[model samples]
Target: MGDDASLTARKAQLRKECLAARDGVGPLRRAMAGTRLYARLMGLRGRTIAGYLPIGSEANPTHAMRVLARDNRICVPVVTARGAPLRFREWWPDCPLEKGAFGVPVPTEGGWRVPDVLILPMVGFDAGGGRLGYGGGYYDRTLAGMGDALAVGFALEAQRVEAIPQERTDITLPYIITDAGVFGADGTV
Candidate 1:
């Protein structure tokens, strides 16, 4: 197999393992972890924040979104097309939501904005800030274009792996928040 093909196969295998681990988390543990994740994000400073609604076994940031929305603008990602970068739309707790691409909930209205901070969901990550997403490349493309937005990933501590297969198009996240603690891109926690 070629380099790209090999990397793709490796990623698929890792993704499966990581997702299973996340899915195996009990409901009570997941809830506690979500609370901790929200507490960690409270210290960050950002006027406009983008957060994702939990899908399946992903960690939910709804608690943080509620707190941030009280004093800051909150937005959620909307997948415009199959291969297009995500569009950020203003969202609040009670905003009308409709299922978007991949069955993820997105805001119904169309007031878009650029977020100063973006909280992303991840399947797995490494100490070096390499993130394993759902292989959609949406976050990578969005981060590449966002310039200076603080990209923070949300995941459970069990999702951490020794390393992730990297591609030229991949974008490294500066910070990843987990139930245990926050990990930095430079391998600091």
Candidate 2:
């Protein structure tokens, strides 16, 4: 009981610290990071992508999502319920969007789709591709069901942490795209 309580407390503390670090980053820098992210992913084609709309200090992946939509299908995650895995809804440039859970925008009405790749926005990430999200466990649950899909985290280098305190249900992303560069299973690319 004591160990479980301590771990939960530690994860909560880390989440607060990570959010602070992300919030501390300047808006211009954050936009620049998004630009770089777009450049890295612009070459992707033909694969269905599950991207996200940035909320608060989350590193934005919309730039890449827009470009990829030219040759690929782009979708955004929808929070259907508290513990349910997120559902992906098709999205495109100028797609009708209404604020969903937590004020994150979602398609007003679109067909649901599963993605071949997931570009996850993170509050903090370690070199090992350990992601610290907003503690909702949405991505974790989503990833669990999509084990074959490649999960790539997106964040600014400022959100980099030495390590992320994790639980058994936590998922480790094998690839992370940062403002600096991409972190892969072997090393930064």
Candidate 3:
């Protein structure tokens, strides 16, 4: 085979691997475990927390009922309007939820507020804190203005890239938590 053909084959193989890894249920469970551990380590008790609904390799804490059961205020993002910014609404475990844009679960009606901590999902991330999302830019755009809020991205250890594909608008996560551990300014504590 030619060089181009070999490179193309390699790219295809990587895409297949990523899809398989992202689709597996085991990775989600592991990542969720990592997220819960970090939440406690970060002293997240009683703080307002926001988490996105995971679609792929992104960690999904939705199953961790304990986090919601705790005394913290929980918020989730809802796609209110196209070409508009994301709006986060306060949510509770028992609160009624409806499917918003892209089929992501969200609160139907409420006021928006900034969260003390934001647990984000990513398709890929790196040690330098770079994150590649699902291309919607919702989390990135939403967290951009949150200077005082802790921005954390959750992922499986497998999703860690050597480095993320850089772009002008890409925001760095202050904390990147994987099943193995957490990284960034907090230094894995």
Better of 2 and 3 by TM-score: 2
Ranking by lDDT: 1, 2, 3
TM-score of each: 0.94, 0.93, 0.77
Task: List the candidates ranked by TM-score, beginning with the highest.
Answer: 1, 2, 3
Best by lDDT: 1
TM-score of 3: 0.77
User: Candidate 1, residues 1-189: lDDT per residue as tens digits?
Assistant: 598888999999999999999888777766766777677667755588999988998988888898878878899998998777888999988889989889999989858989989999999999989999999999999998998888998888888899999999999998988877788999898
**lDDT: the better of candidates 2 and 3:** 2
lDDT of 3 at 150: 84
How would you encode candidate 3's per-residue C-alpha lDDT over 17-82 as one tens digit per residue? Answer: 555665674855685656654554455567778866655455666654245547677788777777
What is candidate 3's CA lDDT for residue 8? 48
What's the number of clashes in each of the models? 0, 0, 0
The positional error of residue 5 in candidate 3, measured at the CA in angstroms, is: 20
lDDT of 2 at 27: 77
lDDT of each: 0.88, 0.86, 0.68
Q: Give the TM-score of candidate 2.
A: 0.93
